[model samples]
Target: MEGLFQRELDPRWARTANNASHWATGVLAGAQYGLVAGSVARPRIGYGVPLGAGLWGTGYAVLPAAGLYRPITSYDRATLAKDLGAHLLYGLTTAAAFAALGPARCRARKAG
Candidate 1:
């Protein structure tokens, strides 16, 4: 925001906005996965890696176009590998957690 205009930013608000954006992105991704996995008879943990890799690759393509990041080619292989590794972990953990929770119908049946 400061870059767009000459005005200074309030650090507290900046942090809050940053945190909110991070959370919103995570929530959106989780909801999307839930919708997808809910339709499956068995949701596999392995499915999440492709989701994560897709998100990472999409960011590389979209962020650069939006001017948030440089082209993927500008980064070294090691750096890209490390970033992709983190994203893969995110995907795996998301899938694992979703699987552990099971479906809402299962939980309802168990409760009854």
Candidate 2:
């Protein structure tokens, strides 16, 4: 349909989708952290695990800002490499975060 085509071709729609996805991901990550905090008897471990998760999530959410305001410089193969490297770093950081969180809710609850 014409309406569908307009929506699909719009850059604004993609940006909105990206922002919404980021917000949802952050909230879910925060909830996972809270669940981890709730499950552990020791408030320290409970807090630490979630804190780590949250720190990483927050870092992930803000990291896009770094690439957003890049300086206008000469373009070269090196520039391309650096951009790719940054993206790769982002992916690795995201993996490390989820791995570190590692299903904090999966273990059986400890009896009080």
Candidate 3:
């Protein structure tokens, strides 16, 4: 994962620090996704799928422009498929966790 990210970065920034930064970025991204998922009313698999897919689509458009990652078109089919699969999995897992936590439902339950 680090190697892949490093490849897209400028030579000066392509070092251990950048790899660590990438890992940190991933962690932060996961947290943001969790927060979004948790805020949903009923957090189900259906909800997660679209949320994750939307995020992936948005990242493809934004990340390259931001210089964080390469454009989706630059990657080969296998890499693109792998990334899509990973994003889907991340979304599904986040939704499952959110459903289990049931933040919105719990709030409603308590209020009622």
- TM-score of the candidate numbered 2? 0.34
Which lDDT tens digits does candidate 1 get at residues 1-112? 3422345556777777556755787688888998888777778899889978987898789756755457899999999999899878888888888887777667787799
Q: What is the C-alpha RMSD of each candidate to the true structure, in Å?
A: 3.9, 11.0, 5.4
Q: RMSD in angstroms, candidate 3?
A: 5.4
TM-score of each: 0.76, 0.34, 0.63
State, as a TM-score between 0 and 1, how close model 3 is to the true structure.
0.63
CA lDDT, every prediction? Answer: 0.78, 0.48, 0.71
Total backbone collisions for each predicted model: 0, 0, 0
State residue 35's C-alpha deviation in candidate 2, in Å: 0.8
Per-residue lDDT of candidate 2, residues 39-75 (tens digit) = 6443342344345444444544453344322233344
**In model 3, which runs have C-alpha deviations exceeding 4 angstroms?**
1-40, 103-112
Candidate 3: tens digits of C-alpha lDDT, residues 7-106: 5444776677556864675577668866876676666766668766876788788767766667788899998888788778877887777687786568
Measured on C-alpha atoms, candidate 1 has an lDDT of 0.78
TM-score (C-alpha, index-matched) for candidate 1: 0.76
Candidate 3: deviation at residue 74, Å?
1.4
**Clash number for model 2?**
0
Q: Which candidate tops lDDT?
A: 1
